[model samples]
Target: MTKRIVVLGVSGSGKSLIGKSIADTLGYPFFDGDDFHSQANVDKMRQGTPLNDDDRKGWLATLNAILTDNPSAVIACSGLKPEYRAMLRNGLDDVTMIYLKGSIDTIWQRHQKRDGHYFNGREMLESQFATLVEPTEDEALVIDISQNADAVLKEALTLLANSPTH
Candidate 1:
């Protein structure tokens, strides 16, 4: 079965960087979920406003379509809520979810240093955490992001390899 790896986490948790590395290692396509968002959503985020669930429906559908089309792909997305994750899972199988977990201070520091990110500053990160429903073991392969990217990627691959879903 084709593997659909969703590298999920809060903003600044290195989802994009880690997802790209995993894609490179697995020889699959890589997608940044931020690209799937509508301009309005981007605008709202740029203004430091958190996206409400209503604002994300279309974006989720678009990502769902992209995943449906790709047999094997690694996508960096903030699957913060279970409902949001479920929305992403519609019509898909062979999905291996990786939750990149991290402390607020660590990620907030990372968020501060990042440049040209639409998730500007650390304003919405708190909101993101507040909105998040951390995925359990049954829902995703969880890995802490306190380690280096290489280590995180290695662990994610190992967990995916061992996961029943994969």
Candidate 2:
């Protein structure tokens, strides 16, 4: 059976990297949720302004549409809130959520090393952490991000392979 996966995490939690790895391993398409953001949202984030739920409504809807359209794919998204996750999972089934759990300091250090990204600064990272409503054990396969990327990917693949859908 085809599997639809959403790799969830705050910025710099390696969502894109892991999601892409999973997609490639499974021969599925990979989509970065950031790529779907509107120009205005991008500008807001670029300016170090955090986006409220109201600002994310349309963007989330578009992401929902993308998930709805693709039967078997992986997406890297910050499914920070329960409501947002629900919105993304609307009209979909058997969507495996993988949360890349990490501390602010850990992610912040990684964030600092990256370049040319709109989502920058410690404040923005803190805001995301403040806004994050972590998924319950049943809601997502939680993976620690302190380990190296290869270990995380291996663990995620193992978990996904054992998930009901797989």
TM-score for predicted model 2 compared with the true structure: 0.97
TM-score of each: 0.96, 0.97
Local accuracy of candidate 1 as per-residue lDDT tens digits, 6-117: 8999999999999999899889999999998999999999999999999999988888887899999998999899999998889887778899999999999888888898
Q: Please list the residue runs of candidate 2 whose C-alpha ends up more than 4 Å from where it truly belongs after superposition.
A: none
Return the top candidate by TM-score: 2
Pairs of colliding residues, candidate 2: none
What C-alpha lDDT values do all the predictions have? Answer: 0.89, 0.92
**Runs in model 1 with CA error above 4 Å?**
none
| Residue 106 CA displacement from its true place in model 1, Å | 0.6
Question: Which pairs of residues clash in candidate 1, taking residues 3 or more apart in a chain or in different chains?
Answer: none
Per-residue lDDT tens digits for candidate 2, residues 1-166, read 3388999999999999999999999999999999999999999999999999998999889988888888888999999999999998888877889999999999999999999999968999999999999998788899999999999999999999887641
Report the Cα lDDT for candidate 1.
0.89
